[model samples]
Every structure is written in C-alpha cells, then in structure tokens.
Target: MTSTAASPPILQFTDVSLGYGDFTVLKDITLNVARGQVVALMGGSGSGKTTLLRAATGQILAQKGTITAFGQDISALSAKQLQAMRQRMGVLFQQGALFTDLNVFENVAFPLREHTKMSEIEMTKVVLDKLDAVGLRAAAHLRISEISGGMARRVALARSIVLEPELILYDEPFAGLDPISLGITAQLIRDLTNRLNCASIIITHDVPESFKIADHVYIVGQGKLITDGSPDQLSDSTDPYVQQFLHGKPDGPIAFNYPVTPAFEQWLQQRKS
Candidate 1:
C-alpha cells in the first residue's frame, strides 16, 4: 500500500453534511482520498453512502461544511467550471447504466467522443485499449443486450476509465456477481487504481472483497461516521456496531426494524378503535 501522508489529498470533506431538501441524511462527515489510494465506504442500505457520492459529484450541494475536489470547492464552481471539473472524474453506477442499443466498443467510447475531438480511428484504439484492460476486448462488437451481466459491468468499467479520470467513484461495483466474477472485479479495481495512479472511492457492502482491495475503510451508520481505519484495524475493532456489521450478526447496535413514528402509532390506534 502507498502512503499518502506526504502528499495532499485529491478529495477532502470537512465536517460535511448531505441530504435532500429539509432532511439531512449524513452529518459531520470527514474523510479524504489521496492519489494512488482506494478507500472503501461501507454501510448498510439507506445509510447515506450514495448521498455522499451525490455531494461529491455536485449533483447535490452539502447542507453544511465543505467539499473540495481536485483542490476546488465544488459548491462554488461556476456551471462551466463544474462541467470541466467533472470531465476529470468518472462514475460507475450500481447498474452499469450502459446504452442498450450501443455495442460494447461504442459504450466504452461514449465518453471519449463526448469530451474529445479525436478521429474515429483514434477513438477505436482508445476504446479497445480500455476494453482490453478489463479483459473484454474480444467482446467489443457485442451488443449490450447480448452480453452477460458481468460483461456489461466490465463494459461500464471500461467506459468509466476510457478518459483516464483522476478520480473514480464506484457505487456497488460487486452487487450482483458470482464468486469468480466478484473476485475478478475486485482485483481489477485495485489494479486499475494502481495503474492509473488515481484516487478511488468504492461504496459497497461486500466487506471481505472491499477489504482485500481497500487501503482504508470508513463505516457509516446513524447519520455519522461510525469508525474508520485500515481493514486490519477495523477487523480488530471491538466497537459493537463494527463487530455487528463486520460479522453479520443478527442483533446489535443496528436494528432489524425501522423506527416507528408517532403518527403511525396513532393510525394503528384509530384502526383498532
């Protein structure tokens, strides 16, 4: 693992809070991602992991504190400036989000075509190179619908890296894969981050896989950062929440049922009446 202690971080969040209108989902969050690092953001469903991604991408502004990406305050960037900054980043969404009508090669080439003025020949070479990196070069001509789910995901990975982004955000990269494909994807994520010398933040619940590739890990719950450290450090944690989450215990700091509201109780009373 590379030490980022001597270098400035590529992305930083200082006491950040994020959410939709009138509701803050995560609060007082602080974290940083440095070049040549892969940080895993782990949490249960509805724990605001994706909300952090939205704030990072400028899809939504932080409700409080600051978010600095590539040394720029994303909240303060002008529309044109934000667009330019976004071009330096790439996102692999949970479902791959490929264009169903486009073939694998074209899917991977979409970002290059949209952002650069390269000729068709140049675009083809770039797309094929990225596809080859993901071990899907031969499937370049296959339609999106004709490939397996894992292949489609690889195509999405190729697309995300075709531009060679400085920051890569992966949202549930291993959500729906068999053991073999899952392991392959995890290793690929680590290899690509090292090869690109870029910063990566993976938001996933797959503890074992994420830990294998992650240099750092942050666990979120109950609207705050529960804890953060290296995978080994987290594994040694005695914090009840951490133990429960890491070991998949049925009961602990995390509850199996959602909290009930006063209105819900009143409604139940009225129904009984």
Candidate 2:
C-alpha cells in the first residue's frame, strides 16, 4: 500500500504499557510513525526503548493499551494474522544477527526466498540491488566471519530491506559503531527512508545522531515519557533531566543509587540484633 503525506500513520501506539510478567518497562506510551517519517526513541539503557519495538512487532503483547501496525490492532490479531502482518515489516537487530551458515548474498536473499516465489534470476537481481544499496554488493560471496562489523551491519540492513517492506524498525543500529561508521549508517537510514517513502522507528541512545535524522523524537526515562518534540524543541528544552541528558552532564534528575537498603543502617541493625 502506498502512503501520502496526508495518510494515516503506518504505525501507532496508544497508551501502551509493555513488559514481561509483573514488571512494566514502558508505561503510557503513545507514539506514531507516519509514512516517510523517521521517529527516534531516545533513552538510556534499560529505559525500555527496545521493549517498545518488540511490542510493535507483536513479539510481546502490551500489558495495557493497544499497538496498531499496518492499520490493524495487534492485540486483536490471531497468531496467523499477526505473522502475516509482520511480513510487511523489517527489523535490523542490535547486533546484526546474520545467519552464520549463510554468506552475505544468501543472508540478504533469505527473506525473498522465504516470503516470495521469485524465480532464481529475479531473486538474484533483487538481492544484489539491496546489497548494492548498502554498498556491499562486492562482498556478496564473503562469509559472515570475513566481514568487518560495519560491513556486517550493512548486510543486516540490506537483508531487512530486501523485501521492500513498508515499515522498518531499527534497534540500537548505531550501537558499538565507530564515529565514521555511525555517521554513515545514520545517513544510510535517512536515505532509505526517503527513497522508499516508508516509516521508520529507531531505538537508540546516541542523542546527537538521533536528533540529526529524526523528524520527531521521544525521550523516555523510568518507564515514562520525559518529553517529545522536534530536534530543535528538545534542544531548547529547560527540563533539568532533559538538559542533563542532552548535554551529557554527570549529574541531574536521574539518581545513580540503586533502590536498596542503606548499607550503614543495615550494618547497625545487624549488630544490634
């Protein structure tokens, strides 16, 4: 389905609370990814950015509220229906989780083979086109072990987009990358979003890079949204926590202490007993 500027969002989450079992990692989450928009989820580690991605993919049901993707409410979908919906979405995992048993070409070709009955010639052309988009067509025959970290990330990106999905979810895409590779990957993501005219949700902690490419940004902390706005708005925020995070300050609203009994008090109590 093609989307225009006025079309409804391709993805939406409304008051969603997500986590496993008894603990909630993200609460009252409301976000959307419109066609041709790049939305970045910014937070520190354990702030539940990746959990939101998982909820969007229907890998985990929200503890409360609803998640809608491709115009369908995810919680209402049966297993088969959810699986079908997921076929239209692509995901680039945090670690570039490529298939070790497959070479670069085969890794990118896997989705095409699994989802479509394209002929061998057609599949080869499509796979090469995707790999070429990520600047890795020359290394098509190389083993996963033979590629550098940056190259492997490119291959993962290629694999994710080979099917030409309408939505792409990137989880920690810039994690562990050097400055040069990080910048290159960020540009590649922005270019792909524009070229394909698809919506994207990026889960990341890199503030400057996220602000650089994002059409909208949502900052989360302690399982709640801290602020949401355009890059400029966020940059100009006066919220103490937002200011600290944006400037990479050592101290601010966030506390470093773990929620545990005070050590000196515990020792005194034990001695008295």
Candidate 3:
C-alpha cells in the first residue's frame, strides 16, 4: 500500500499559534492534511480546533508561523487572491447552516449559482448529483424545516461538495446524530474524500466514528497538540493525555477543572480590590 505520506499536502500548518487578541488557544502546532486523506482534529470543548479552521480559511491571521494552503502562504495572499483561494475550499459547519428560506435543491445549488454561470439545466444536474451522493436526491423539493436533523446535515454535506472543492473542512460533523445517522455520515465523509480525491479535515469529538474513517488523527488539549498518529498507533500510545482522550478516562494528565492562568488571577485580584 502506498502511504498517504507520499501524497502532497493540501493544507500545512508549521509552528503555528492561534488566538483571539492576547488569549492564545493553541501554540506551536504543526500538522498537514494530504490529498485524498481524512485527517481528524480531536480535542475537548475549548481546545482551539475551530481557531485552526479560522486560520485555514484566512479569517484570522496566525500569531506566529505560517499556514500554507495549496502551497500558497495564507497570510501573504492579497484580498482578491484570498477570495480566489477560498473558492477551492469548502466548509460544513457544526449546525449544517442551511438557508431556512430555500428548499433542498436550491440550497445545494446556491454555490453553483453564486460561483458559476451554468444554465439552469446544467445546475440541476450538478445539484441532483451531489444530493444523490448523500442519498437525499429525492428530498430536493423539501424545505429546510421539513427534514430531520440527520437529513439536514446530509443536505449541508451535499451543498458543501457541490463546487467540488479540493479541500473540505468539517466542524463537528458527527455532532447530535443518532447511531444510524452517525454511521451513515461517517461513511459518506470517507467515501466523498475518495471520490473527490480531495483533502478532508474533520474537527470532531466523536472518537470511535472518527477513528474508523480518519486516515490520521491529531489530538489537542491545554493549548497544544497532545499527539497525532494513525488510529491504530494512537490506540497503542502510552501517553497519559492520549490515553485519557481516546479512552475517555476521567483521571489523567487532563484535569477536570480549567487551569487558572496568571492573567485570569490578576483580573480576579483587581475585582477584589
């Protein structure tokens, strides 16, 4: 088997640190997602996975180091250049983020309409084809409120892929799904990456499902990358943080309470004064 490492990376983060203002969430991060591979970004609630996504899309500039997408440094891109670069990428948000006023077909067709001048007939074919990939082609006419949460998520997936982007970012793709829906979604993510020959980065907390589909996994906590490896390699890891995250251990290197930072303590002291 040819290793995925031999594949060219679509996204690369080198010595990266991300934050809002003065509060840094992640630091010294280095990771890559190659073509045709699904990389899982696993972490707890406030562990900066979303911040990395923001940096990837150039919504926020990195505090340090570089984020390279498709071999172009994100920070160096001009505004127009960044917009062009974004056209090659897709994002599936945590809540599906479908348009409430549009029907299923229109929702999926939104990207094609906004980005391409394809005729209605051509757009119809493309929209149906993407919906079919997610097993929701027949729900084309249904309004957003008419579908189940699982079905809505699939519709969002179809919409995200409608442009056939070279890079896809999924934020909590497996969140709030029943077992059957979760399984179907996981399988679809794996199948779509293969079919599109694209890179996928899934920011999720679901371990078993993500492990089953991810080509590589990165776990983060306490403002840094704890570890990264293949699912099997992570399962065999002896690191307390890795073991704690993978097995859902209550007691380990990761504590229950959030740490009290010096900045936070200083603020508290000022309040007391």
Candidate 4:
C-alpha cells in the first residue's frame, strides 16, 4: 500500500539533517513551503544558510530525514531523474556565476541548449526572450566581464529562468549590490515569482530587503530555525537573538557573543580613548 500523506507540502523537510560526511550542520530541521509563496531564510554568518540552500536543490546529500520537493523524495531519484528535477528549478548563485569567457546571450542560452534538443534558431529565440524579460536583451552580445555587477545578476537571472522553472533558489542575491541594483533585484524576484506562480527561497541577512519580497520568513541561528513568521511578526518579536540580529544592535545577544580579535579590540579602544 502506498503511504499517503494528505495535502503534502509543495516543499517539505521532515526532521531533515544536512552537512558533509559525519558532520551535521543543520539538525532535525522541519519546514514546509506552500505553493506561490516566497520564504526568506535569514541568519548570521555560519548559520548553515548555504547548506540549506544546497539541500533544496539536491546539491547536498541529506544525512538524515527526507527532503520532498514537488512531492517526491529527492534522495531516491536516479541521475536522470535528478536532472529532470533540477530542470524544474532555477538557481541564482551569490556571485551571479556567469561564464566570463562567454557572451551574455550564450550564457543565457547554455541551459536551454544543454537540456533540450532545440534547433539553433529556437534556442536563439528563447535566449533573447528571457534576456528581454530581464531587460538585458540589448547587452546580449557583451562579454560577462564587460557588464556591471547589477547587469551580471540580471544576466544570471535571465539564464536561470530560461527554462521557466517552477522553483527559484537565490543564495544571497543581494550581497555586493549597490542600492539601485538591490532594489532592482528585489523587484525582479517579486515580479518573476508572481508572474510564474513559482515559490522562491532567499537566504539573506538584509532584513529590510527580504521583508520587501518575502511572504514568509525563517530565521536560522546556530544551524537551527529559531523562528518563522510573517514580516510584521518578526519585526515585533522580542526574542533576544531575533531582536539583536534584526535591529543590528552592537551589545545584544549575538553581538556580545561574537568573537573579537585582540587587534580589532585594541584598535577600537584606541579610537574610543
């Protein structure tokens, strides 16, 4: 008999443990993302945000529990099945990761040409369409290195969405971005998720930026989810760790415990005195 779970989540992690061999960074983590929602995974440094991001895409092998993406066990998939699963998701790396050697058009078209047996003319049309959607069509012929950081991210976004994925994972998409770029990227995320009716997961510490786009938020501390809620609830939360991190305080729970080197301490003291 098939084990039936009523109304299973679109993405579910049941007591899932993750990390490298014999070392678990995230332990007994449980969460579910409903369809058409954006979830932000917030945390400080070393909070296992990257690990969870990789787990979502099946890039990191789960040491325990089950990861169900689109209603199937991600661990049970064969190579072909995994490839098929990955195709349904779009991932934007923190660095944008566009190929420096390739021009923007080629970079965007790479996934389509690799995954599908489309003709060159068909591939070109698809690439152009996606680039235009991200407002980078005019720079299609420019080399990756030629574009600014914001343009590079737009190109990366164009490439990720070329296949029209149902899930998009952004691993710190806002880092190193100028205010204008950060605003654009945030809007792009909101627009694309709404337009495609796909779920989005962003790992970031920029609370305000995440608040602008996230329908739901999850906070990870010391490799565990300390809390999960809507932006308003999180903003009003009095949890010490949550309060400290969210308000960017200097003497709160996280800051008091953060390691300070002797050199930096001496420097700070000298400046104050």
Candidate 5:
C-alpha cells in the first residue's frame, strides 16, 4: 500500500485470526506497520510468525476479524483488486526464490516487465539501481546456481525493492547465511528500511539478529501474540512466555511437548517389563 499522502500505517491487522482449513495459525493479531518503521514478528517454529506474514500479504484470508493493507480490507477485495494491491507491496521469501531460468538482472527485471510499460533501457537502469542498493550490481549477469547464498539473498532483496514498494514483507531473511553474510544481510535490512522509508514486517526466529534490525518487535506463541515492544523492553520483560523465548529455555509457560495422555508413559514402561 504505497501512500505518500499520509504516513498512516501501510499494513494493519486488527483483531485478525487466520488459518488453513480447520487449523488456526494466528489468532486475535492486532498489529500495524507505519511508514519508515521495521517491525519484527518473532516466534518459535510453528508458532505462526510466517503465517502472519502470509496473512499480511494476502496469500491467506482471515477466518475472523480484519486484515487491512493500503487502507482497504483485504478480505473484501476481489481477485483482480488484490493482485493490483500486491503490486504495491514486495515480499522476500526465506529462500531466494529467484527464477531458476533467469539470471540476476532478469530476475529483478521480471516484475518491471510484467507490471510496467517502461522501455528496456529505463528498466535496465531501475534494475541496476536496486542491485547497487544491495551491492549486487556487479553480479547482475550471474545465474542463481553460480552465486553464493549470501549473494542470492542480496539479489532477492534487490528484486523485492526494485519497484519502490511502500511495504515489504521478509520471511526468515537470515535463515541460512554464514556469520559474515548474516551480519551483512542484517545491516542491509536496517539500511533499506530507513532508505526506502517503507513499512516492513520481518518474520524470523533469530532473536538477536531480528532485534538489531527491528524498530519494534512482537513475539508470538501458540497462535497468539505473547508480547510486543522495543528490543530492550522485550528483553527486560517479566512475561514468562517472553522470557522463555528470549532465553531459549526448554520449559516455561509454553510447554516443550505436545499434549499427550499421562497413562501412555506408564503403559510404555510396563510393556518394557
């Protein structure tokens, strides 16, 4: 939702609950991403951080409550309307989901070619500029297979912001990078969030890295928001769930094991006898 007129939130989820078929992934999620802010959604695996990103980008509709983007209700939009809305936003998947058949330049140019009537020369300039932003302009001709993982992620980042999207959604942006690459990627996220002045939501399990890049953070657990605040506030929180997650503890308010029958343990022990 690219709105230069006012700095209202580019993305908002109000009392939203989203799910797949019979299983709910995120419940009662009320969050907002105003322009120039980078918000991180942090949680353990299967805790619905990625699901929240999916909901924010309209990949899934809310089963309950409202998911709004660009100042409009996502659930109310038609298919065509939703597609148009998505064009104004950008998404970077966990794996650099570049086209296997296309080189770096073409991958970044793909969106401009599909969405705009810009001339090839103009498109080339835009693509190069984005590549430069992520320090990948020199590797513009490299195929996905030829580049390192970090370079691929940088290319993906370039492609995501090529269109100057008002909002960007990043899913596990630091998933599989070396220490140096991880640091570089984290810095890029912080720089781009401020450079583009765009609202962003980063969904990641990497607590330290996410905190370094995020202006605000929300922690989720069992389909619900456990807590939210600045990095320091979250670190200083007394909430058991927040403490458990930040400290990487095995036992706390959130149990380590899934529900199971108490008698099953004894039954297995008896059978061994």
Candidate 6:
C-alpha cells in the first residue's frame, strides 16, 4: 500500500444499495475511509459485509446510490474506467483465496504483469519487495497449496499490497486462523496500514482482534447499519442485537430458528415419542 498521508477519503459509499437481479444484499451503506485509517466492518453472517466491501472496490455493481473511489464516481465509470479504478484497489478474500495451482511468487506477480508494461525483471523486484514486506520472501517458489493456512493468508496479504494501492478491502481476515496466527496476522495488518498509509476496510467477526487495530468500526444487521462508533463505543453499546453479537449471546432479539420453529418443533415432538 502507498505510504500514509493526511489525505481526503480514498473511498466513499453514499446510500449504496448493491445486489443482483432484484435482490438487494447491501442497502444504503454510507461510509468513507480517509487515508491512513483502518475501518472495521462487523456483523453476523448474512449482514452484507462482504457485499459492501465488493461495492466499495467497484467489484460489484451498485444498483442505487453512489460509490466513489480514488476521487472517481465508481458507479458512473465506464467498464474500462472501472478497470482503471480497480488498479487503485487491493483485495484479500476470505481464506486468502490464492490460486492453488500457482506458486507464491507467480501469484504475487500476477497483478503487476497483468496491469503494467514492466519487464519481467522489474516485476520480480516489485514482487520480491512485497513478499519481504509480509515476511514471506523465503516462501517465494512454494506452490500456494503447499503453504500452511497462515502462510497462505500472508502471501495473499503480500499480493494485495503489491500494487501499493490507495485502498485495501479485506474479508474475514481472521476467520479460522489459530490464535498465534491471528496475532501475527493482526500485527502485520496493523503495521502495513500504518506504514503504507492506505485506507482499509476489514470485514470480520473477530471483535477484539479487529478493535485492537481499527480506528473506527461499523456493524450491519437486518440489511442496514445497526451501529457505528469507535471500538470502545461498540463494546459498550446497549443495542440488543449488537450486544448479542459482540458478546456471542445465545438468546436475544436475533432468533436462532425463528423462521423454521414450527417444523423443528414437529420433528422434536416425533423424536421424543
């Protein structure tokens, strides 16, 4: 990611409603990430965190409202213009999502070669530098499938920052990672955002882990933003759903099988008899 600067927002989503066909997965999302801050997006599964992330980076279409990135109106940009705008975005999907067939070095170099006219020799320098930043320079030639999960995540992190993008979108960066791996990943992300100075939006359920690094936090539920504030505010919130999610409570306004309660009860009674 680019080095930090006290710049204006690198990404802004204004009343955005995003989805496919007629279903709106993310509705009226409004948030802005200025340069040099890590904004965490928190919610339960199906809360539209991933959908919103995709929209912010111009990966998914916005059916209504506007999305701006790198000072360009992303929803209004042409296909080629959107592609150009994407050159400024870096994304790390859940579980790294590395190409299992490619080696680490090639995986990281893929974007550089595809987007730029740089010679292979120059591209190697960029790839190696990015690998070094994520402490994976030694794993360059290993196939992505050979690396441990944590290592793979780090490799993906390396690739995401290889372009030195102005904005980074990370989905579930801590999911399924062990405690030690999570610590390493968390510190690495914190350092990278600080050093690169790029804006970041992290989608995660790891409340404490995310709060440790986040400058701001927003939560989504029931197709809308449920709460937004700094880590402290969210942690102390009295909002029933937000509190239930943050604390991992079993019984709250969010029902576990409310939609299927009648069917479940019928089956349970039959088994009891």
Among these predictions, the greatest TM-score belongs to: 3
Give the higher-TM-score candidate: 3 or 4: 3
The TM-score values for the models, in the order shown, are: 0.95, 0.92, 0.96, 0.88, 0.90, 0.88
Window of ten residues with lowest summed lDDT in model 1: 255-264
Question: Per-residue lDDT for 220-261 in model 4, tens only?
Answer: 886577898889899999999999889888776563354444
* 163-218 per-residue lDDT for model 2 (tens digits): 89899999999988899999999989999999898888899989988888888889
Candidate number with greatest lDDT = 3
* Model 5 lDDT on a 0 to 1 scale: 0.86
CA RMSD of each candidate after superposition: 2.5, 4.2, 1.6, 6.9, 5.0, 5.1
lDDT of 1 by residue, 1-273 (tens): 767767788989999998776667889999999999999999888888999888889999999999999999999999999999999999999999999989998899889888999999989888989999999999998998899999989899999999999999999999999899999999999999999999999999999999999999999998899999999999999999999999999889887665464666888999999
lDDT of 6 by residue, 133-234 (tens): 878998999997688988899999999999898788889999888999898888788888888878888999898889888888888877778878888888
Looking at model 2, report the run of 10 residues with the lowest lDDT sum.
255-264
Clashing pairs in 6: 4-197
Clashes of each: 0, 0, 0, 0, 0, 1
Give the Cα lDDT of each candidate. Answer: 0.92, 0.89, 0.93, 0.85, 0.86, 0.84
* TM-score winner, 1 or 4: 1
- State the local distance difference test value for candidate 3: 0.93
